[model samples]
Target: MLTLSIFAVLLLMLLIDIPIAVAIGLTAVVFFVAQGQSSFLAMLPQRMYSGTTGFTLLAIPFFILAGNLMNCGGTTQRLFRFARALVGHVPGGVGQVSVVSSMIFSGMSGSAVADAAGLGQIQHRAMVDAGYKPTISAAIVAGASTIGPVIPPSIPFVLYGAITSVSVSRLFLAGAIPGAVMGLAMMLAIWLMAKPRNLPKDPRANLHEIWDSFTAAFLPLMAPVIIIGGITTGFFTPTEASVIASLYALALGFLYRDLTWKEIPAILFTSLKQTCGLMFIIATANFFGWFTIFERIPDALITQLAAFGTTATGFIWIVIAIVLVLGCFIDGNAIFLITLPIFMKLCPLYGVDMVNFGVVMTLLIMIGNLTPPVGMCLFAVESFAKVGIWSLAYECFPYLIAILAVTILCAFVPEIALWLPNYVMGAAG
Candidate 1:
């Protein structure tokens, strides 16, 4: 009866188009009120407060601010120049630039939506002018943008880590390999598709031009290295690393004379607005999570699943299948926050390492950003590039298959995800 009621309320809220965070919070409140549980009501505020007050969560705002700062401070243009020199000679040169720029920007920004919005403007115009199809250009930007969370300083990773109590530092390390693999996969797909079409390539830059772009992008490129290096070396926590990243971005912008005093207010305002929206979602998720716990939903799920098998590998594949289906509907972050506690409870039964699980989960969530209905990156790129959503969706099939193949590889072989972190950062303490 309780489960049915909860679902009903959830569906009702969804039909009305309430924000996900609000729907979750309201559903939880309705559940508690109906049960007439006084204790649960008392616990709600504390749970909500604790959920939003984590020291680890401080990284969210810092990273958001840093990304905004980098975008505004000329990092995007420098990286674009570097990408063009490196890959602009290929068929669909500017198309390739979109993919490479997304890869580079992933290290700094971590949000696919931001990547699409920021890089889409530059890449779309160039690709259109070069005689590429608008749908192809839009599809490329949307597909490439999914790479953001796979790279270090990933916002999704931080949120997942906080919810599941995994080490954000180790998750950052784990993402390095998979992120690179995804980028390569996308590049290969583009090369194959674009070659037969005889798409135009940008003239190869000479040595002086290549060297100039490289030198200009050098500092911005090092932003991820500094943050990841500091965390892995025990010099600072993830929160502290975020602060360092912001400071570093600020320094680069000031030194490069890219960020003027006039731009400071706009930057701050943008960061603050984005941060508030994200943090509100986190806070509301906290309230919803409290209700989930009080209802014993996770424990019920564990007991039921235990009836099948207890092995880590089996449980992982099961969860992956579930997330993929869910990905077709829900936004990635909402899925993460709502389902994390359930997964965390199940992890111990399978003896799965939370750090490795974190990486795998991040990959799966990113896949969602590329798929249909509610894919954030897909919609953003399609709208901006003025391509029909259906056409872009059809074109994305091959890329989807390639990404699924890589995801399956990561799932079966945990070493691909964990090796770099262990080798480069040593074991997490």
Candidate 2:
């Protein structure tokens, strides 16, 4: 039972505040050591190197750099104005702006915490100043931030593609419809909650203002186009697209005159810092995945699950439930890296479509980001807004349900996740 023991050690390490990358790598080491497989120790370096050396993974650092550059390039204010022009007249004007801005920003950041801390704080302050309850404001920001990872250029999708050899471009297309549906669903939830509270509504933007804001946002808005369009049209690989996106973001910084040459070094350093941490986790998780395979965990799980009378849809529902429960206590990326190997292996056996499964898994794990106790976005918003975690979680419940409904819809109607991909990329195998 070395597998079980090593897993226990990993959980214990996390509970004791060990970093995930270290915990995972250490756990794998424990497995090998305890088994007296000293010979395998020599191969550790090679395994780690092989895991991180995938050409597809080269895209990660570039994308992270592109995101950092976009953030530093004065895109937020322009996008905020554009979102306000579009949705500031909705029932919950300030709150709707948070949702719409997140949708726009998600195309760039691909990060919930970044979205929550950046645009989220802006929306949170606005809603609070408009006399909304701090709890409600906190909930709106947290809920909308969940959209960050589901939109195009999501970092999580990149990780999944790197691990599973799925086409990153197809994964981007798969997220389009479901992401939009989620944004609309959250907006509807916002409208319903704010209707009872009589929240303030900003005046609808006239054509002139809307046009001006859109014009201002033009360069920043072209980011996803430059990245996605270039990748889809076969002009560049996803890796090359990231490099191109990074340069475009830098040029936009010069054009905007907000990001300066003097500040470039610090920005690169910060981006490098973040990328290194993620790359470590990816590397360690790859180590863990290798050991798990060596232990035949997937085989054991398949045999165990086979006896349960599982069918494709039934199995998906069960996986969703388990993922949701685990998500409450673990980081989403960790959860994804830890569980995807097992679940992805189950796909062909259950007759599940890998593309659809990847999309659904990404969405479901993100919904976990708003879950209570340890939801990353929840804590990030709570800390900044200074709202009680449970209080904000309570307010986010309805929105959580709205997200769950979307997850279920996308889960059953695979077309919700696959339609765009199939239409654009041809049928996935």
Q: Write the per-residue lDDT of candidate 1 for residues 1-429, one digit (tens) a residue.
A: 555567568757866788877887788887787788755777766777788888888998888888778777788889988999989998768878888988898888778887887766777877888888887877878888888888888889989989988888889989989888988888888888777877788998899998999998998888888888888888999889888988988888899888988998898898889888887778778888767877998888787677765667778888899788767666788778877877888887787777878878878887788787767888878777777777888777767776787788888888999898788767654
Error of 1 at 418 (Å): 0.7
Q: What lDDT would each prediction earn against the true structure?
A: 0.82, 0.83
What's model 1's overall lDDT?
0.82
Q: Which residue segments of model 1 deviate by more than 4 Å?
A: 1-12
lDDT of 2 by residue, 330-417 (tens): 6788877788877888888988877778878888888788887678999889888988888888889988888899989998999998
Provide the lDDT at 57 for model 2: 77
lDDT of 2 at 415: 90
Instruction: Please give each candidate's TM-score.
Output: 0.93, 0.94
Name the TM-score of candidate 2: 0.94
The prediction achieving the highest lDDT against the true structure is 2
